[model samples]
Target chain A: MRHVATNNRDPEPKPLSEPVFLILTSLADQPRHGYALLRDIQDISNGRVALSTGTLYGALRRLLEEDWIERFKQKDTSRDKQAYQLTSEGRRQLRLEVERMRQLARVAGARMKESEG
Target chain B: MRQTSMTILWLYPAEYREAFGPEIVDTIAQRAGEACLQGLAAYAAFAAGEFAGLLLGALREWTTKWTARDGYMSPPDFAVEAADVPDLQRRIQQLIRGMEFAIANHDFPKARLYSDRERIMRARLDRLLSAGNLYQSR
Candidate 1:
């Protein structure tokens, strides 16, 4: 029997950039198209991160290339309304990112308390 | 404004433009609409930002293309279909040729990049084949 190599190892997740982190977080709830992603990202950041369409699509392409997201077919298959959803890998990465942030915050809080005392 | 935005969109690499052009245009239109509601200053700022972003994005994408790290190397989820086997094979052949040419030219870095792409493509091909999807041998 020929041994077929299975490339199934999950590599350790690196710390994500801010835009990537926001994009993944936006898709954590449900699938969204280009415009929806832009709006939601802004809303998520409380209007601080207003991504231009080019920047948004650039990030989307990278996410797709990483296999962390996939194009979702919806009834509205109009030229501009293609939706995207997070893959399981993407969700796992997001969860890991959140945990990383929580731990950092915890450490910072402890140090602040020690300083105050 | 839409026309100007489209013109800027044209500056992006052909593959990137084809994949996301219409959506980017639509998004820009929607953003412009929202900006229109906020008054002239907001709309002006939005237009300035949009043009600058698109120009910078086009430059970056073109640079990425020249650097051999475009979509050709990455296995996007969409490429998993069995129907893509032939296309994948063709890409693998091209990568081999590219690697050989790079070696002949003493461009070892480029050759290594091609080698990496070949490995990834072959792995993807193996996965598709192992899934038991019948594809015509090419």
Candidate 2:
């Protein structure tokens, strides 16, 4: 197995990039392939942002490196074509990101609604 | 002929995948048998690039201040030079040539590997790339 040195020993780390934060979160619900994940992010963002190939693969690698996500593709098939899925760590990270977003939304909503009224 | 390698190269996202769509991946299993030198290069290059991109992308996001940018300016002016994606086809083709030459002549070929290195370098680019100014949105 190829190995990359770990940057730090933290057990639970935050998503390093927006792409990864989004990618891992996307799979929090279910596993997906390269294109499918990109489409889902686009759908949710309502086209405000789209993940390019570089951004998509970039986050996928980081998530894998941190052991946050595991490669789901079958390497035994002897082909480089591979797929990936969220690991337990990845799921936890996704949950944190979701809650963080939720909290921010809640605060923003109260302020905006109160001001309008 | 090396043209057959094109089938293998086509399996990767940019050259064949983006151009031909998902059809290439379906056929990759059938055509990958003893593929020529160029095809092997394409496969390795794609994987290497994918690995590099995944690692660096996460690192950048982990470091960037996504929330801090909110309500700061008119629009986020992110740096484009950092956003550029290297040409995958050229690197893959070169890698194939390097390996083929090394195998046929029995020596290390540095050029192809160098090309691969350059592609990988951009992923880990050290400078901070700001997302231009700032833009507000929900």
Candidate 3:
């Protein structure tokens, strides 16, 4: 067995990048393949964000490394059409991010209302 | 266009290429097909952005390969019982053998699949061994 370093730990959870966040959101509903992820992300972002294949795969690799997403064999799909889905940990992280944004938006709205009044 | 993209994919690191090359190619081909339906200009624009993205992504993957310690490759945080060691070891061995066979046959995608499974099993094995050592020290 290799000398496994048990001391290394994950640091604090930083905010996910737009691409990462979108990718997670795309997979939140169900598993998707590479092309599917690209289309879904575009739809979710209302065509504002068009992820290149390279960008999509880069984020996928990072997420897989983090265990936030997992690859699973999907029926009726070719071997090359690898599909990915969000894990429980990924779902939790996405929820946290949504909550954070919601709170920020609420505060901003309240501040604007006070100024208007 | 796909041939061009396939050529560009070679710029990525071997591990990354083996893992994602086909999927990237398939996605690019699909996008290209969609762009073709719009017009020549649209297809050209898509090609330009796609190629540039592939170049930058290759650079990023190389940087990650050199600098990042993959979390999955590290020792796991979960505990493992003594009895689970043998089963984990067996699975790891099976996965490694499968990976090797796939590699030998030039089935990189299949090899990558085996490698991913093997990595998880290896992590579990490490946890079990670590747990045993901790027990011995006590």
**Candidate number of the best lDDT:** 1
Q: Which stretches of candidate 3 lie over 4 Å from their true place?
A: A1-12, A77-80, B69-138
Candidate order by decreasing TM-score: 1, 3, 2
For B46-117, candidate 3 gives per-residue lDDT tens digits of 999999999999999878767753322232211122236666666667777777887789877667666665
Scored on chain A only, each candidate's TM-score is 0.86, 0.71, 0.86
- lDDT of candidate 3 over A48-86, digit per residue (tens): 999989999999888876667877556653454578988
lDDT (10s digit) by residue, model 1, range B1-138: 789988998898777877778878888998899999999999999999999999999988887778654344244334443236777788788888887887789877667666665765676677556655644543
True contacts kept of each: 0.52, 0.15, 0.56
Best by DockQ: 1
lDDT of 1 by residue, A1-117 (tens): 111232423465678999999999999999998888999999999999988888888888878766677675456744535788887768988998899899999999999999999
Give the runs in model 1 whose Cα sits over 4 Å from its true position.
A1-12, A77-80, B69-138
Ranking by lDDT: 1, 3, 2
Worst 10 residues of 2 chain A by lDDT: A1-10
Candidate 2 Cα deviation (angstroms), residue B25: 9.2
